[model samples]
Target: MIRKIRQYIEAQNLCLPETKIIVGLSGGADSVVLLYALQRLGYSCVAAHCDFHLRGEESFRDEQSACTFAASLQIPFLKTDFDTLGAAHQRAISIEMAARDLRYEWFEHIRQEQQADVIAVAHHRDDSIETMLLNLIRGTGIKGLGGIKPKNGRIIRPLLGVSKQEIMHFAQENALPFVTDSSNLQEDFTRNKIRLSLIPLLQSINPSIEESLVQTMAYLNEAGKIYDRHIQEAIPAVFDEESGRIHIPLLKTFPSPESILFELLKNYGFESERIGDIAHAIDSQSGKEFYSEHYRLVKDRDAFLLSVRTINHEPTTYLLSPTTREIQQPLKLRMRLEEITSDFQIKKENAVAYLDADILQFPFIVRKWKQGDKFVPFGMTHFKKLSDYFNDHKFSKPEKEDAWLLCSGNGDILWVIGHRTDNRYRITERTRRVCCLMMECG
Candidate 1:
């Protein structure tokens, strides 16, 4: 088994000869065997154990046994205890998931502190089979079916090419001391239930079930590589990294729009079930939006805009006093009271607003545009709904979302910042004082 692990490691180029490795030693049969095998293979090994405190004294016993074994092998040992149940409750996750998260996170921390080149975990062929089955039951995509990778970032699984039976046999033959977790026999957990009942029944039908599944996983992994390459090539044309947005034209450029969208959005915390709805919404309306845990996807006129969901800023109204020359927050605007002269030239830029100061009330308010908001656009006689104005001007959903309105103290719209000004505040020839407002993005 050690020779086989050595060959697998060499073939995969998982680590260099002099590379320091940290093994996640749970003192279980699989992990114990992994630690001893890596040591026998002449690699610098450090043992790191996590006591999840799930099985009372059994958990402490496991930790003690792991430390003892590491000492016997004269290896550097590190261990940490976790309140598994409390963590599960806090994270709103299952006990199994919480424990897994805690252990892997600690292992990575140990790896970096120890200057270890790689962290080794004892995940064998059987574990990969179980993972594939679990993913299938949970409605996973192609990547899930690809099964566990031997090397993922700084973690390496040398035992992945071997079976659980082989690992046990090697442990027994080598007289390796290991502690068993009694919780493994319980049917309360989904993984344990699958291992205890489902796998045994499958093994009854075909004794080589694990081997067969391993081969299937290998094929899927290769296929996933090809799929990944295609996604990489399609990304350049379909995604704008600078703006963190995905171009919906990818639907027309790709054969499978839903599949492509799922791949693109999956990393952004979007679920598979929501991808279909988002794809359908892309063709329906420009203002349609969808949200995931961390991101929001807006269906614009020509593309889908993806952005991180930030804390929603409270609707704040900033008062621009007559003495105030500039206000920065919400939007940057420079205001000046200029005496109207024959040489006074109105700027062509929409960002610059020349309003009649005599008609304006003091302490103007700058706020976000709200529903039912109306404005008498410059050169227009009748008031138009702000929503209608946005549509008429061909503002995208994002553009409308970022729109702000400047109004007088009497609640009359003065300027739709960066767009249009109300004709009610427009400078007339008879106006003596002009409030020139120039907006600049910070």
Candidate 2:
């Protein structure tokens, strides 16, 4: 096992000698064998076990056994506990998915915390074949069909080229005792079902199904590298950034937009279905948008633009009711009452006024836009709907929601946030209060 592992390391060229290696130990046959094999090779390794408390006392036993194995080998052992069932409940996903999430997360946490250069998993040739078959059954892209890589970023699967049969033979020959997980015998999991039901049927035809599939994965892995190189080169051409937006012009070049969208999104770490939705708006007019966890895509001409939603806040209204008063939120309004020597008129845009001063109220409020809002413009006497104004201005749905509007307690729209105020609030010839309000709109 040590000899083959050394060969595997050399073939993959994982890293240099000063690099620290951390092994994920489950106390199962594969992981135990990996721990034993790694220790014999003397590659500066440590065993890290995650006790996903799903199997009750069995989970604790797994951790104990892993600790025992590391103790016997005089290697450092790291242990962690997690509630597998509770995580599933919180995520509202299946137990299998939750366990997978927790497992990888814990593995990465330990890898970083321990400063390990690579986190090794004990996935053998049979496991790789099963992964390929599973991906094929579920429908996957070139990367997924490439199966588990021997070295994926910080992960190194040294036993990926070795078969389960070889590991068992080596364990038996060395008098190694390893516990078997009963779940492997059960056909509930897709992988177990493939191993118990599908591989045998395939072997009936090829006799060397596992070997053939592993060779197939190797070929696909090479092909996938070439495909990935093209995708990486193609990204800058397709991705566009302007006015805080991202778009892909490649959709128009291809007759099948879906294929392009899927490949593009795969590069962006998004699901294919979401990419389909992004491409669906290609023919639609501008301002059409789709949202993801961290990014948003908006249609712009022939380009599919990606945007980061950011909030740029500004002061709402300027009130001139008081002689000398300042509004909070970095905004201040100036007001002064001066007798006019000659007759003159002030436009609504220049200053605010009202027909009467008896109706004016104090403690004026300023705020952003609200739903079901309507206000009269400075020039127009007719009330304009905020939604209609947003539509006319070609604001996206989220942008419309982000717009600000100034209103009064009496349900009067004083100012159309950051632009101008209603003519009803303009200073006129019969103005009793001569006031001015200043806003910090940026």
Candidate 3:
């Protein structure tokens, strides 16, 4: 078992020899075998365990067993408890997902604190097979068929090359003490159902089904390498990083455009179904928008415009007193009171707005533009609707949404900031003082 794991680690370049490793020990057979094997191979190992507090006393029992096992080996042990159910309710996620997230997050924290080279988890071959089957049941792409990888960033699974049966046999042969969580015996979770029932039913049909599935996953992993390379090479043809746009015509020219789109967008939190809808919008009308949790993708006339969603929870309104010099949030701006002198020439730059200091009041308001907003152009005598002004300027939807309005305390628009200043607030010949507002460049 040690030799198999060491070879897998070397092949995957997971870590260096004698480097400190943070091992996730759940007191289960798989994790116990992994910790024992890693210690036997002469690597510096620190045992880390997470008590999710889900299974009543069983949870504490598992933690105690893990702590004792690490003590028996004279290894350092670290443990943390989590309110798994509370976190799930708070995060609006499943209990299993909440526990998984909490466990990995705390493990990474411990790894960095201990200065470990990498984090090792015992996800054996059977776990990867279960993951693949789960992804298939949920409807997945080609990448999902490749199963769990041996290494992902700082997380490494050294036991992925060994099966669950091999781990159990090795644990028994070495007389290693481990505790079993009763949750595993109950078919309450989808994964447990798969292991306890579905796989057995398939095994009854074909006794060697697990081996065949593992072989199939091996083939898929190899094919996935080529597929990934193709995707990376083809991305340059359709995506423009500088403008954050994907050329629709070029995208449609590719075969299986939906698959390409899905691969490109999956990391942006977009699901497969939404990605399929986006692909279908290629021939549809422009001005359509799709939203993920943190990203917004707009179907423009010629391309897809992708941008981050403006955080709604952040303050949209900001106040600036006469003595204020600058503000960083709700957009950056530098403000100062300037005097009108003989040689003082008003700056004509669009980004610099010069307001009459004598006419202006303290505590100016800066906020996002809204519908039915009206402002007078610097040269025009009449008020113009902001929507019309946007249309005349050919402002895109994103640009209009991002526009900010600087106003007086009386709720009158002072400047359509960074674009045009209201005529009512412009400095005139009688103005003894001036307020210069400059929008800082990013």
lDDT tens string, model 2, 1-442?
6788888888889766666889988888888888887777767787988877777777877778888878988889988887889999999999889988898888888888988888888998898888989988986778888788888788889898788999999888887767777789889888999999999999999998787788888899898887777666565556543444334455466455565567866555566667777767777777677766666666755566565555446545444345435554433333334444366445444234322333446545555566677877767779888778766766665555545544554767776555667767765666664434444434
Error of model 3, residue 90, in angstroms: 4.6
TM-score computed on alpha carbons, candidate 2: 0.72
Tens-digit lDDT string for candidate 3 (1-442): 7888889889988888978999999999999999999999899999999999888898888999999999999999999999999999999999999999999999999999999989999999999889889999988988898889989989999999999999999999999999988888999999999989989999999999889989999999999998888899778889987777899889878877887889888888999999989999988887899999999999877788889987579787998886677888778888889788899987789789999988887788999888999989889999999999998997767878889998888888898888999998888878999999989866
Give me the runs in candidate 3 sitting further than 4 Å from their true place.
71-76, 89-92, 112-115, 233-244, 253-256, 311-348, 353-389, 404-417, 420-438
RMSD of each: 2.4, 6.1, 4.5
RMSD from true fold, candidate 3: 4.5
The regions of model 1 sitting more than 4 angstroms off are 241-245, 310-316, 340-346
Q: Residue 52 CA error for candidate 3 (Å)?
A: 2.8
Query: How should the candidates be ordered by TM-score, best one leading?
Result: 1, 3, 2
TM-score of 1: 0.92
Task: Give the TM-scores of the predictions, in the order they appear.
Answer: 0.92, 0.72, 0.78
Candidate 2's C-alpha runs over 4 A off are 56-68, 78-82, 90-93, 101-116, 226-244, 248-251, 254-260, 263-271, 285-388, 408-412, 419-442
